[model samples]
Target: MSEQKNTYRSIFLWGDKKIRPLEEGVRALVKEQFGLTEADLDQKYLYSDDEVKLDIAPALSEKQLNELQTICGNENVKTDDYNRALHAHGYFFGELLKLRKESIETPPDVVVYPKDEQEIVQLLAFAEKEKLAITPVGGRSSVTRGVETPQGGISLDLSENLNRILEVNEINHTVTVEPGIMGPVLEKHLNKMGYTCGHFPQSFEYSTVGGWVAARGAGQASTGYGKIEDMVLAMHVVTPVGIIQTKDYPASAEAWDLNKTFIGSEGCLGIITQVTLKIRPYRPKNTASASFIFKDFETATLMMRKAMQSEIGVPHLFRISDPVETETAFRINGFVNSMSDKFLKTLGYKNNSRCLMFVSIEGDKNYTLLVKKRMKKLAKKHHGFYIGGSPTKKWLKQRYESAYMRDPLMDAGIMTDTVETAVPWDKLIPLWKAVRTYLESREKSYVMVHISHVYENGANLYFTFLSPMKKGDEVEDYRVYHQGLIDTIHENGGSLSHHHGIGRALAPWMENEMGSTAMGLMQAVKDHLDPKGILNPGNTLGLRSKI
Candidate 1:
């Protein structure tokens, strides 16, 4: 067999008794290439019994079951375990794939909650003993299929078990929180202590710190502070083999640092349980946003590109909502149409606007004012009229609720979703125009975009579209949208994903994203960490057969 095929075959035969001794060869290839040891290869590298069962599926071996029961206890696990496990994976890509994609289901054979790091180690050991395909589920808020298991396995839902503020190191100005704590709660908890974790996503209300780190998620503040990779100081993870602790280090003369590998592993290399994240002492933030009257798309897009490449207007949050999204968000917010008779006529603000650039400056009032001044001067140079100010009062009132737009579309049975990517300043405008053409050229729908996060390197724009969710062919339509978006994005020198990860929906095209060399290394790392192909299989960097 070809080496690739042999690798695939070994993964498939991992559970057979005859394969145990020979599993060493499979393990050796992974270990030698990746610098891992036998303990790393042992299914028992961490702890467990063998009796856990996902659901209606048969219970695992006595050792596996005992390990799971001991780790989770009988508290919240029982006969209803099956549905509870299945429900935990619930979230739709489109209404159509809901049934056809069911086969990919590998529901956790038994869901377990580890109350502490010690219990998690035991659970990981048990998962290794039974060679169970283990999937780490944090918030279950992924729009892409990051945490879904149709057939059944062991899902480690960290929400309840890891919900605690383990430490708040005032000295380092960093706070340590368990993975399952929600975004608002974490921020609220830290805020009272005169610190803030500025990461925010549309799903911020429901997302957890672990999920943020695992997905490498970004926030509005990313333009200023960077992604979770920047915010995380140290991470505590339970890999398939054992617990890997990345201690907090300010700087190191050491040649290599291991903390970065876990940031965007997508739960392939390890399961993130506790994160020590950098916290900024609370700063009163200010917003100085104004509407620009742009005559057309290209001019507005150019202005945005300059703002990104410019140093003067370094912003906490910067966005240029395209006419379509701006119109949609405003109307949905009842701000535009409900404009009492006077506003629209006087300001000439109508659905006719081609774009609206929103910008916010953070840190201190002086810095915010300086940024706003430089931004205003730069905007004027591009014919961008600074017509309004200070979140315009009205926009701030409705700013946080923009996520509800998707709900009505979902209710209307329209399958709508968004994809995000980032490109350098030079390619920014072309990428936008290209993405627009690709979406508009689609067979059955309209696609539009809006710039969200702006950075010195570039900016992030979100492209979205929706169509009637066809019954049997939902995957085809969803593929049409996603493929069109991702391909155009890659062709234009943008990333396949800026934040939302390479979940099951994005797996097939991972090659285009990671490239051959990186993907090869990722595969080696995956093999080293999960030789049995049991750690969140078929998602990020696994074999083609698994995908």
Candidate 2:
């Protein structure tokens, strides 16, 4: 395939030439749920041409392009249609819909790859001087249109060269790294040195450290290891005015926690160059896993809340799936008609009401064992049935691979997307009901929900919904459905987003969610840092600027 075709295809597939086919079981499930026929599955709707040709031309002047080439080398700056198309959008389903139709509405004028922090500083200075917007692109894994250059200036591609593990402070249990490094790369290095960062988002293989920090993301083990904000000790950000570097203090009572300020800035205020993150000893051997089946979602959440508030300990990975998700997972994994399924049925676990909970504890062997025992006891108290570690093992093994399934489903003319939000325990059920009700009200939609990350008082609900694509109206239909879902989430008292940063997808709701005063304060900071509006202009806390 041509480079353009490869680039276009990579947006949906896992890697180059690796399109994971939907399993027969999943295909059957999708057909049944959407009332699709075999012919419908065979009618692939995605663009499969060998060459991706976009009629959009470069918007930058030759003099401006030469200036960028001088700042970085000529080879480091790309103005080709392929590069522009690759950086034009993120992994948002709406963006994918546009790409599937060979549409390029707002392609960046140019893409620049800086080799180091000094180069990034120079690039930002140049962008500021020229009054051009610059959007930082790390891993290109943004699901909220966070990397899109709406004003069409420059895309600073960090994953190209600025990925490196700069320093490892064993004494302080901290690892300082360049922001472009991928999660798997960093984890492999740390694992060889008998350490682990303990942050494993589903996009770990395809996402970058800077993306994680920018998004304020949480991992599967966030329940025990905490979110990226908790792990980030210090960071260096290059803004238009100047570089802001935070000190790596264990704790401080200072007036402003600058690190926290930039943790979820989403590249609106600046570009993150380096980050220092807390690490823990790698102890996978000392891990314990268990699964339970509760009578329903409420009972499962009750047990999870008790486990979290027990004060004894919390598991590293705690997840509870709602009835829909549980049933779907069971079918996809061939759990139906299995021994466990029969056991659950014999124990009076109804089909549409039973929920599944997976628990994983990692630490000292004794501590893990003790926590496992305590969790099991607590589950029993809530009438939960222990189902061994098979469920967790399967989930862990296939967690990252699940992302690739979207490709085949999309090709089969199905639209899939995920939205996540966190809510207090008292409000979780209501919020879940509201969101599900809204989603199900849509025509021919399938909604699956799972509580992924749990805290003492609440948990994060991650919803995956699939529906038949509206053909030429995919993007518009998605916008309407997504807006309604966001509105439903807000009306039900759930946070705008639990981990996915507030990019353009969620920007319109910022003022309503945070109120005008809080947004005004954020705008003040944005204005102070980026007077020229050279940084990411459209999203990030709803601080829009014209460049």
Candidate 3:
């Protein structure tokens, strides 16, 4: 068979082939939100003039290099500067700064593409004997530099030739596929069979199934179908020592499901080669969606909690935005805001001080209507006014675009980033308040928040913040804002992350998040599986001091 062509580009930097320059509407939104003067708009956002200097890569003896090339074809092992540069940075703000400056500190000496699991086994064995580090990459969409290459190692590009579906067991409600398959490609194939994995993280267009499993992602509809961990039944991984494949049975009563242990290993444990994910038939015929406005954040939070407890119906798409986020969403663009303002006036409401909640249910028409009625009643108790589903439809249309908006915002001399965390219901309000208070206190900072992936016990809070660059020190400002939000999340009883994995960006806090004993146990697992520390280091457990 011919090789599968890459339909989408991996890198999304400002001047990359896949990115678009800032549009007028986006520019206007930035100016309005951060009060940027014309000078800020005129600021040319281009690669910094500083030349990227680098130390010579560790020398690989010609004999060893030739053996690696023979193992995986000449074209599969790349040593060019361009390919190595691409593998250096992910979408993290710190990495973006490096890209903007055209400066990469430490990049891989070579990048290797393995055609299949056997090839990966051979590659790992070779690297082990050679004492070379291997960092697994799929789609290269990690926001935390999870795939960053070690000082003198190889970056394994899995998205090249291992992106094919292996099996579709509709009878068993499961689909087995190679880990390198992109999300949209896999979803399209499943849709043809009237099935879906129901994993739709915003990065769906550019991420892969392996990446999803590695990061423990959550789709927008996670309220009903569950997160990636729940959707996975089993996985096939190639660790340094040996292959680790889990049981494919639907439910296992056997000693703790080993599959769950590998779901979010983030390449530290091994390279995930194949995944067997639980699939579901497409949604039913009938559907109902509504947007409601609440008087305050506390009321909206209470209403969502009540809905979670109610047995009327499961909310497949549930979301609630704080007043600040709702207001910013309304004012994101002039034309859009004008249209929404007209609609709000018709309902005798203003965007100010109104938290918005959107809930969608799918099933039979009668049951849909019944659930919506019950939802309305629950909202009414919290003084929430129904605003119909038009707004929700609009939201659905633009949900994925937010991820791409980061480039343009940064282009306009505005530093923009997002951080997410989860907390129990009792601590939810305090966490929300703490994050908002800290961000708003920063100079020129505009912060917005939304709650989603809510469960009976707690919910996830996702925050987006933007601020004008502080003269010539944008990186420092970004560090302050990014670290502040994460620090606040920890102090307020929130997880270090909700969907994003603990890459090097968050590795320092791993011990704090998972106490010393737990962290030590995790390190022990890594040491046992990868005795040579050949896997992705500085990720999860950080550079192994023992090694």
Candidate 4:
């Protein structure tokens, strides 16, 4: 493959391993957080199993392989075991454990990179005729194994030649681009043009625009810019039947919005080849942030709800870290802890018994100042103590690096994962307490939570958990632990997922999230669109027996 082709490397926990070994400083930091000694470190870090060899399925015949090669160039089609293995599992902890052990069960037969929309169309027809399944993937950053290859299929790696910024409608504040364009690259181009897509998922650096729309993602600043579903004005998807291009209009009175159906379809119905997204000029205004410490979780959440519901101004970035997460986050970052000692402790960080909320606002210089001022007033009303701006600024700088920590944590024999769900404000407290209580009772895991993407009526809760691997049964252990959380989410009336799409990990819960009738309608739609069941089977709709 050419150097440009290599530009499509995966990194969000699924790609190549290039992280430096735990340096002495990081070791010291971890020891401080987890209270481990040198011997303990050695014992924990030495956990490794013999690389369980992969049982790759048979490859395509020379003629069949040549047929695909002719469609999208020889270099774009790969049948090597290594490349196939890399595209298999997603970033899920269980998947990672399997990867670390080299125990992949379902590797794709062949991986193909289509150069353009026409090639994708041709490839889909070829797959249909050959009875081969197709899975569309970009950056392969799925944490739910959504991008995993089917039992036997070709993984259409759309990240290669299809990546480009096709057009920028400066007058209308929109940009049209091929689907495989990486998030950071697209954002950089928009920034150069004094505009931004403003969809900054944690996976921004490691994911693609197509993947964002596929997942219907929400960014850290979603309060101001809106979610991916809200940002997409139009999209073009290619399926076995034909191409679907949603209308580009500000408002539609149509009975059913087709774009909404395909926005979070998760590549089940079709392949998203091109997207026209709403963009905004770079906010060239003053920005300020402040941190608040609430005495309890209830008060913190209430304060968040009030801030979001108030008519003064909405903070571009808002987050409330629960007590356990607040402490854990500070403990892991030694520099931030040192700063707390010098400045924040006097302002109440010393207690370490409070939930933390970081609120940031950006707009007209004077308006931004007023927003921060109003935020401080609201916080005090809800029994919040100011902890200054250091923490919030620190959080902004390191927000994207949070995903990188997973690899090292796994290296240290710790199993870590995050799950998110949304619920209305009234039900937030119950869901929050239920999740923490359930996990605490089940596993010896550390759980932390934060609220983001706050709406007037509801908000999203993101929970992160970590625990030592249970010997050789890591996968089974994770399954049980994760199932408990999912149950809690559903019981408390939260959506099965807020931003993360329902990939294979949560496919079984589709019926629970959506009643049988609704789910049947979705299945009916899928069946009509992909009659052969050749598209991403066992994804959002779950695996089904042949009709």
Q: Residue 84, candidate 1: how far off, in angstroms?
A: 4.0
Report lDDT (CA) for all predictions.
Answer: 0.65, 0.89, 0.79, 0.79
lDDT tens digits by residue: candidate 4, 21-131: 555655675566566676655553423334323576546788889899999999999877667876776687667777666566888888898989999899989988888
Candidate 1: lDDT over CA atoms? 0.65
RMSD (Cα, Å) for all candidates, in order, is: 14.9, 1.6, 3.8, 3.6
CA error at residue 189 for candidate 2, angstroms:
0.2
lDDT of 3 by residue, 96-209 (tens): 865776656778878888898988999889988988888899978787778777555888988888899999997899999998899889999998888888888888887899
- Candidate 1 lands at a TM-score of 0.81
Pairs with steric clashes in candidate 2: none
TM-score to true structure, per model: 0.81, 0.97, 0.92, 0.91
The candidate maximizing TM-score is: 2
Model 1: ten consecutive residues of lowest lDDT:
8-17
Residues 156-186, model 2: lDDT tens digits: 9999898999999999999999989999899
How much RMSD separates candidate 1 from the native structure? 14.9
